[model samples]
Target: MTHDTGLVITGLAKRYGDAAVFQAVDLNVAPGEFVAIVGESGVGKSSLLNCMAALDTWSEGRITHDGVDLGQLTEAQAAHWRREHLGFVFQAFHVLPHLDVAQNVALPLLLLNRPDPARVAQMLDAVGLQGLGERLPSQLSGGQLQRVAIARALVHKPRLILADEPTGNLDPRTAAQVMDVLVAQARQHGSSMVLVTHSEAAAARADRVLHLTAQGLQEPPQQAVSAPNP
Candidate 1:
């Protein structure tokens, strides 16, 4: 398939030894669109996201972002590509313990050799951590820490955002709040997002939702509706 300004995955598959994790997966995410993938556990949902990010290898298929084919990139090139164009939010809220909130959010910019404290502050405010940038991760609650992850993911204005069960660790109320911030920031930045989750509520917010299976992605079958008595 031809690459446009967003992410494309064509006939993708992953395997370990002789066992297939998933196969025949195809997806296209338009710029500024939010797509969510839902599947049962061990169906390789996280693995698919990793492949898109170039953090893992696929047994077959092509993944391209904005015309750059991921399979062709060397290790260093992939790292550079991720730094420049990808933002990742993890379920665990992977903020560094040694660094304060602002420092954690500033890492992507620092890696690219472009430090923008103002941008960092803006992201903090956007995620509702306006004045808590000086607090350590240990000092914050789980919900607050997740906000820090969201800020860090968007601080560098990545072209694509890949989140792996980002709300899995939060309570229902906090999960809703976190999704609100994440969706708003991703929209504001015009970043195409692909989120893999088991949460029906989370998937409901996406522009489209697909279920992943070994055979490929397809829309979930609709639930039956009963006729009411007249």
Candidate 2:
């Protein structure tokens, strides 16, 4: 539970055989800071996030969080580490079909054996899903489902949050709201966030915006469209 230092990724590279997806990537995201990485589709943006979460391995370099090297962790150790220190929001809404909103959001807490009904309620309220917790995922719209995912991700007070196109299926207004909720919750809990988005508006909400290419990560040449006022 090292919270003093932030995520440090140095010379990170990922490849398959001789074909390189991305290489020579160097970046640092301070604790509690939010960073957005934007790139063309198929540039391995999602792969980068996966590598950071220890769900995927890298070919070279190191990824350290609070001085803990992710590459050194065994699969079981990585799973345990992720549960305790990471939160992830996926584009597909990954909510279970049979579980109610509250139950879905409560899974993380349950896994950690730290069930807190009040905390679940607080997260639902934070994501504007307060009274709808009893509803199943099938009963919710795309926007509502995404909110449920957001709530679930933030409920455990994780140190690092990785969001991959959370609002890709959302309308502009809903997307804006989702972004607000995500950013607000991350700041409130002092968690570092790394967002991979193709949406310029979403990318603009981050503290810094970087472009990902076959060569590596770098500042974008063109300015991103800032998030519209909600």
Model 2 C-alpha lDDT per residue in residues 1-230, reported as the tens digit of each score: 55458799999999999988889999899999999999899998999999999999999999998778999999998999899889999999999999999999999999999999999999999999989999999899999999999999989999999999999999988998899999999999999999999898899889999999988998887755455554
Q: How accurate is candidate 2 locally (lDDT)?
A: 0.92
Question: How good is model 2 by TM-score?
Answer: 0.97
**Alpha-carbon deviation at 189 in model 1, angstroms:** 1.3
After best superposition, candidate 2 residue 168: deviation in angstroms?
0.5
lDDT (Cα) of model 1: 0.91
User: What's model 2's lDDT at 73?
Assistant: 97
lDDT of 1 at 143: 97
RMSD of each: 3.9, 1.3
139-206 in candidate 1: lDDT tens per residue?
A: 99999999999999888999999999999999988998999999999999889999998888888889
